[model samples]
Target chain A: MLDSALSVFRMGRNMARLMEGLGVTLEISVVAVGLSLIFGVPLGLMMAGSNRPLKWLLRGYLEFVRVMPILALLFIFYYSLSKFWNINLSALTVSIFVFTLWGAAEMGDLVRGAVTSLPRHQWDSARALGLSEGQVSFRVIIPQAIRRLLPGVINLTTRMIKTTPFVFFINLPDLLKVGQQIVEVSGLRYPLASVWVYGFIFIIYFVICYPISLFSRYLERRWAS
Target chain B: MRRARFLIVALALALAMIVSVKAQAGDLDDIKAAGKIRIAVFGDKPPFGFIDENGANQGYDVYLAKRLVTDLFGSPDKVEWVLVEAASRIEVLQANKADLVLANFTVTAERATQVDFAKPYMKVALGVASPKSALISKVEDLKGKTLIVTKGTTSDTYFSKNHPEIKLLKFDQNTEAFNALRDGRAAGLAHDNTFLFAWTKDNVNFVTGIDFLGDEDTIAPAVKKGQTQLLAWVSERIEKLIAEGFFEKAYAATLAPAFGPAVDPKSVLIEKLN
Candidate 1:
């Protein structure tokens, strides 16, 4: 334990370099999370929308994005989307869009499911009470839905953050790349530092993500109460 | 009791079977018996290796790898090419995924500790390239600036070590890293001159910045360390290849158009020892 502690604490230069990678992790997560926040509910509403085709489109698109590998999606956007179609999207922009599309659909699906799962009585009561559709959405449904949506959104937020490491492919320096560089620099001694290096990275991720987990759980318990 | 004992024995046998090491494609004896030497090289990095429009893999590295295979077995057809990428090359080698890597891998001192390298084949080092307005002509020029590089690559190592003051950013693919440099998010890309040449041809906005740096490095074929016989065979073949000016010819025919011809082949090629 002491050895591991020392290794983790001692590699300041390496850790500093790795911290920059955290910027990328945060960038993707923040952007994607922001995106999910903005559009995910709308996407969810679309899934719950009375229009069958739009719901199907949302479901089909969500399922398709979910099924495809994230790496393949990154390549498709970077190589195909820009060159063949003249879409001048940057790699970072594409990561944000692709991840947002993924997150939004997921968020939307979560919203749809949560909102639908709400008692039919809630919708009837709201309509009977003379609330307009917009009022029911903004004033009642979403507010009540937030009780449930909040936790799911938080969980999805963590998932998006954790998956931020995948940006290593887009060459966005993040926690993992720093670990790789440290191993390379340390040479044969890499294994000695490798554990601590990666462990620290894992911890950094956990630190960033654990609160989100806790927050999500707290919401779940409160909602249950 | 008799039935239980039989069942126990069967379970033990099954467990043993599961634990046994599976065979790999690079098994020399198996390959020899099968009359083929299966090798792995990159399928995308241009000039080094790439799939052309016709969907056939062709490049300087492939040509050289084929020539080396031909020397060993008397026919290039005895070679089977497997495609590998940056993320998977080491795993592929450790799993016996490829017999040898001639994928323009830089012979790093650190990598040498893990894998056996054939004799120094070509002298090269990491060089920077950027748009003309953003040209970075020295190591210090990259200081406080974002220098884009491929992840899990020697340039990543090179910049991390010698140019510690420079902020190094990594991309998984050369295209993305180069794109970063092109967009001016990164001041330059730290990579081999070959890649810089090819990328610049397409981007056109940038050219090689700073001639090159780090202890003069070499590009060599790497095999799993302790593959003495294989290592010796390749080292010997490298000598012969250099003597025949095969490196120069391959460069001229394949890479010269993009990189323009080498100014001095004599300085680049490793002189044959034998």
Candidate 2:
């Protein structure tokens, strides 16, 4: 069984191709997460502020993203946007765009939740100290909110990573797609190829996501102390 | 008020981006100007369009695509390959992601409405492969039994439309459909006979007992709808290739080894144009 399993990797460059696929997956996740943080933090701050119209608008965006399926979003951006709108983005670009949109929305919601969860007295007390609104926001609220937001942010990053496989439908050769290709080709010689190939993919995903979750847990404990 | 104005400007810019560029299908001249033809092929379906162990595209469809590119640009390297799944074949063309689709795309009436098919290079029919223990040899044999098919394939269309009595289990990819068959999640797996012939050879336990099902169909290259100049050029090129017996060489190179001695080349190859 082990020999048969190892035979999958022995096939020409299957391991390397899988690694390349992993690279694509990480590339999408990292860029999406980076963009999400850059945009989401500010949007969350605005949503938590006194601007009712801005809050309502961000709320609508968040709800739309939450209600719609990621797969549908990917299809719309990759196919319909290009065909009807003539915005010809490559599959990878479209994947990143959709995921970033989703990640930013989720991150914004997380930030809003963390901020709103704080007691009204925390704000009143900070204001009573004669700190200006900007100073209160920067010195008092954001630091506390960051502690509350860290776990959710890390969780979203891992979710985005796992969700990266959905890009396969649009024909981006991510890790899962590449693994399926390897299994199909190797199945000609080894009938048990899928077991090993999918198993290896499982291991790769676990290796990526487990470390992230562990880091989140470590931060949560340290911050709580 | 400032935020609202900023949002309006952003929306206007987005609308401008949308309306500025008109979606036009690339013609032969456009392809020549670009210096590379984007051809979509399958990365999973073996003996047709599949990736080799070297992580490079190889198969019968890919072989033809490379030849088409070489004939067009005097070198195969001028081809930019766009790997696609079965369901996205037409969408890739419609979205202008590929100049041509050579992804074992069977010519069907429904598909013909969406994309213009070039002259056929191969012929095929739906085939059902099942375990030797309980082989499904006829359409009626699949009645009330679950049949696995890849979504958006001709087999899926045929079963869904014609044989509603059969419970169909559809997967998005060929590998998943075949895996469902191997795991006995279905009674039989239905796909193109050409693919089943190649597949059954590798999987000794399964037999394509129903070798030919449904009306015989031809597999052809497809371009986005209304690409008249490109379509005419592709048709003429296909006729020339047929006349020169390029498909026979492709069959010998790719399909012959995959099909082994049991299947004959003439059974699948379309050597002449009507």
Candidate 3:
């Protein structure tokens, strides 16, 4: 127990190097998820309310984003943009761009689900009150659907945070990448170095993600009850 | 529901069998009889093995695998190329996912205990590169600066063991490390000298400093441990191929496009071992 405790302290000193990486991870996750909500909500509303042709085109796009692997899409964007146009953007930009694409599709689907699940009477009642079609969606439907959208959005935020590790493939020095580098550097010092480093990473992930997940659950329970 | 469940289970079993069959390692005669050899080559590293812009697999290691397979099976098409990364090339060979790995694989004593290496086919050493504007040239210049290295590479191990003061960023792929250097996120990118030579040649903005780090090492193909028959056959075939100028032809065809005119096969090739 004493030996293990000493190792943890040693590893803690090393792991302090990863704070900047954690900051990077949180920064990108917030930007990607925020962008997803900003754009995805409107796209979702369009899919829900638009004409058949527009809806079909939007649906096709959503499906494409949903089905395509994020990692593969990241490579396509990273390599193709750099090779063809000489636009060698930073890894953080590429990551935020790809995650926005993925998160938006997911958020759009959530919006569609939440909006569609509302009874037809809700739409009719809003229109019955002198509200125009746009006003009905904006003032009546979306306001009520906000409760339902909250839990799903929070869930996606957690997932986006989890998936930030893929940015390492493009050379973004995010949390997981830093952890890997730490392990590579210090793993040989003691057999427990990897365990300490990886365990600390796991705990850090838990601390960040657990609270968000709990908040999501609390929101779900609050709304449901 | 019961019948559907049965069908699903049967299908899963069949799929499992097929996957297991695909991963089986063949002995020397079984491989020849099967009329195909599965070789793992790095899909990221250039000049040795990599996927071309056209999406076709092409490079020195790839050319050698094709020639070796054709010489054995009488057809170039009788070879399967499995794309492997630096860290898992030997694991792929050990797992029977590949019969041989020709992925610019340097023979290390630690790796030799896990996989059997054929005779040396090329000589290589660690090379460090930095941006031209940085004026960062050698190992000493890397003090208090971040250097990028691919994970599980000799450079990563070397720096971790020797120069612990130099902060290192480890990327899983070579392209990522190069990108780090390109983006100015890292002061230097260190890896095999041959690869650095090719990289600096292609991207002139970066200059190679510290042309060689540590002692020189030899690159060779690796097979699964205890596969003595396969090992002997591969070693003998490489020696014969070297004597018959097969490597020279391969070098001219694949690497000469990137490595330029002065590279002679004999300087890199090792042959005629028991």
Q: Which candidate tops TM-score?
A: 2
Candidate 1 CAPRI category: incorrect
Per-candidate DockQ vs. reference: 0.02, 0.63, 0.02
Write model 1 residue lDDT over B100-186, tens digit each, in one string: 887877776778886788886777756788888777888777778888889977789878887788888889986687667767887
Candidate 2 stretches with Cα past 4 Å from truth are: B1-25, B127-191, B205-210
Question: Candidate 1 chain A: worst 10 consecutive residues by lDDT?
Answer: A182-191
Q: Against the true structure, whose lDDT is highest? A: 2
Question: Higher DockQ: candidate 1 or 2?
Answer: 2
DockQ rank order: 2, 3, 1
Error of 3 at B57 (Å): 32
**Residue-level lDDT tens digits of model 2 in B1-274:** 9999999999999887666555334788889999999999999988798898899999999999989888899999998889998889999999889999999888989999999999998999889999999999888898889999999888989889999999999999988999899999999999989889888888889998888888899999999988888899889999999999999999999999998777778779885756
Candidate 3: chain B TM-score against the reference chain B: 0.71
Backbone collision count in every prediction? 3, 0, 0
Better of 2 and 3 by TM-score: 2
